[model samples]
Target: MEMTTEILMSTMNTTGNGTIDGGNDVVTLLSQVSNILILVFLMISMGCTIELEDLKETFRHSAGFFVGMLCQFVLMPLIAFCLSLTFKLEGAGALSVLILACCPGGTLSNLFTYWTEGDVCLSVCMTSVSTAVAIGMMPLNLFIYSRVWTDDKAVIPYVNIATTLVSILIPVAFGVFLRWWKKEWTKYVTRFGVVLAFILIIVVWVLFFMLNPTWLFAGWQLWICAVLLPFLGYGFGYSLAILFRQPHFKCRAISFETGSQNVSLASTLIVVSFADSPLFLDMLFYPGLYAVFLYIDSFIVIMLMKGVMHLKKRRNSANDEDHDENKNDKIGLDNEGMATDQEDGVKVVAMKQIVADNSVKTDEEIKV
Candidate 1:
């Protein structure tokens, strides 16, 4: 049976009280507040890692940055839209995928880049540039892609998107200012931001269980989104870089940057934007699941990168060994040739001496 858009959107109606039609008002309030705080912390911490030089460096090598942007804004969103259509997700499930695809590369990209021995500077630059660009691109991407599938543009929370963009930029700019003013304090402040981020992740975990314990078994489409989204990002990201002939390290950086969406930001947007919707309970559950799978998929990518590096190292070492063995064999042949020449010279010298002795002996016999 096909469900109508109105029925899907009406899953939750607003009650006279501050709650969703059937959800608890207190839970909704708590989730929004927590989401705001978490987004702030994650954005600020992400900012701390960016320096003015990193921004300039992105411009210095604008080609690579633009390539990364292509991957971030173009390839990923298209992949997600295709997946959404494939899964035939409706309502929140569909929106969740769209929102994630529109999000910029996460701070986790930098960490993964370092783990994979990628160009950290490029990774940082890409992350910062993408985040800043996302302020505008996020909305545009959603507007363009979501329309392809759904006609109800009202389903999109445009105001929340603006709010999320402003909220994210302010804290991030402030963090960057702090780093510029007191470089010494960036470490401590960044550490604190990380702690807050972790706490927020935990809050999300708890909310999943406390609010919607049955989400895991609700739908297979969500699982499809959770598993494929990040994998596609990683695959397409690396492929794009290689296709463009980007250096290997930069390729790795872009791969991680593409795959790791800012879960914290996505969570905040989902929680706050959908807070008033009756479908909040049903729709809000997918972001957390997406987060869980994104990380898992990224971890797998890291391990694969490590494994590739290990194999490359082994192959290089084998090549070096073969080169050395070839050199040794050449040296041995040269030494053998030198010994043969030296023996021939010695024999010639002895024969000349013998001829001179015989000539002297014949002269002495003539004198006698």
Candidate 2:
């Protein structure tokens, strides 16, 4: 960890800037195309999971929905900004946290929410809603937070990103249309999207690491920020849900939605916006780490929640058994007490009879 920063800088500096070239670079164009396609499919996939009725119900009881939105739009961006300041990050390192934090929740969160026994409807809606609003939210956040926090004056291309976000929403709208018109096809689309997403993640991971090996030695600041961003998001999100008095299942959904970000989107943004930057690989490092670490965190969290609930149920059953035993013991003692009272009554009767018999004998002697 101590040498990570030194290694990253020295390694990248020695190897020149990066292979991404500029905006017109062939690799950059290919990357942008790929990202757009994947994002469209994923967005469509996400939209299919949401029912029109669920969305309507979600809006009707919008407390959880609003709380989730607050966590994603408000808490997450602030967390990223604070981390940037705390770690004293600059340039790509600073953008690493900011970009990941700004991107919408990932599709994987729905699956995690399901596994965690959360409100699947709420989870799917929150993810979809966040993405739907990302066009406005992402740019607004980056605009507000990026300037003050990042010491390096790396160019943040706002217009291009806004355009990109608008373009991405088309497929999601189409997917919703499908859900409304041909409900049966939505399931098949969803399954295909899931498979495609996993394939994309694996392919990107392999290709990215292969292209830039030394990012494995990225600075501790990047790693720490990556870990902290999602963890804090989950904690604060769940806390807010509790504060708002949401149910347990709803809280888990909100927490996962809050914590899980779209790494694919963030990486795409980095590739599209910062391809010209000298620190492209460095910018890529944090999102990759976040993807791995947070998923591990999710599994650990899911198992812990399941285990904790199981233990609670067992303890409750044990207490109930003890309560039954105590009731039975009380009934047995009451029966014993009744038997003792009956014996005492018999003794009293016997004494009375003896007294009566003695009195009769005295009367007979007096008469004689």
Candidate 3:
């Protein structure tokens, strides 16, 4: 939603009745600029992780991406629909949840994939393919899921979708080119991009809650649903990948891709779809919750991955140290055995010499 300059941006200055305050044009512009900057930087950071080889490696086994699409377009929308029904939610709440559920995997998933050491190329591809697919799937899922509660057939936010695709693909392309051209700079760009992406995600999170101040009081049901959808997506995607026996790294990538939705896209769709409704503001609530919770869970998952990696590293280091020490001890023992053998050889030589001298003395006595 931070990237949606048309509608989601309006939420930054939204009054109590869903109208964006016209007076804060400067703040809005700055927010818009920062959002774009964030998008470009993060996309580039993601691009550095991609290479022709990774792409070939990714597409070589198309199962992971295919499974990702199934999770994004199929499982997620169903989860949202089920959540809405399970919560007995109606009005904007149900619509927003379902709309969010239908969104493509967000770029942040790619970021998370990078952090988790998952298949970055696979992640980037999934984000691109899903966003493109959402042009059709968003409305289709909205039509299928929202039919129960609302009469509005969501018009695909063509501008938002187009802008999102261009914004994503171009920067990523540039990053990919930059990577190939100045290979040395890829690491620097990647590091900067990762840090920039992390900070911007936090910024967006704070901005959403700040803009929608009442969202904190929006109740636990909406909050729980926000937490549930992504995790369920994660679990379902991961399980599906394991069932298909995807590589471990690819599983993490697929899991992150499935769980993370383009809530920004969802917000854009909500604005286009519900802009005229009386409950427009209410409908906007769920996406914000989903965004924040999705990120919170992302932080948790990444930290856990880091922790596990750290433990493994330490274990390997200790094992290496122990092996080195054992090797040194063996070397010392071998050296001591060699020294002892040399000493024994010298003693035997002396004994033979003495015996020869004795024989010489006996022969001299016999001659006398």
What RMSD, rounded to one decimal, does every model reach? 6.8, 8.6, 3.5
TM per candidate: 0.72, 0.65, 0.83
lDDT of 1 by residue, 1-368 (tens): 00011222222334457345445445545555666676677667666777888767767877788889999999888988888788888777887777777888876676677668787668766776787788778868878887764444333344534554566568768877888999899888877877876676567556534554444764889888889988989899999999989999889999888988876456555555565765556665566577677768978988999999999999999999999999999999999999999999999999999999999999999999
- The TM-score leader among the candidates is 3
For 120-172, candidate 2 gives per-residue lDDT tens digits of 77887787678777777887888888887443333443554454455545665
lDDT of 3 by residue, 1-368 (tens): 24334456566466789666765555556556667778899899888878877778777889988889998899989988889889888677888888888888888888888888888889889988888988888888888778798787787888777888888899989988888888899999999987876676667555554455666767677988988987898888888989988987899899999999887778778887778888787887787677778877888878887798789889999999999999999999999999999999999999999999999999999999
Worst 10 residues of 3 by lDDT: 1-10
- Deviating ranges (above 4 Å) for candidate 3: 1-5, 9-23, 317-368
Scored by lDDT, model 2 comes in at: 0.72
* Clashes (candidate 3): 1
Backbone collisions counted per model = 1, 0, 1
Evaluation by TM-score, superior candidate among 2 and 3: 3
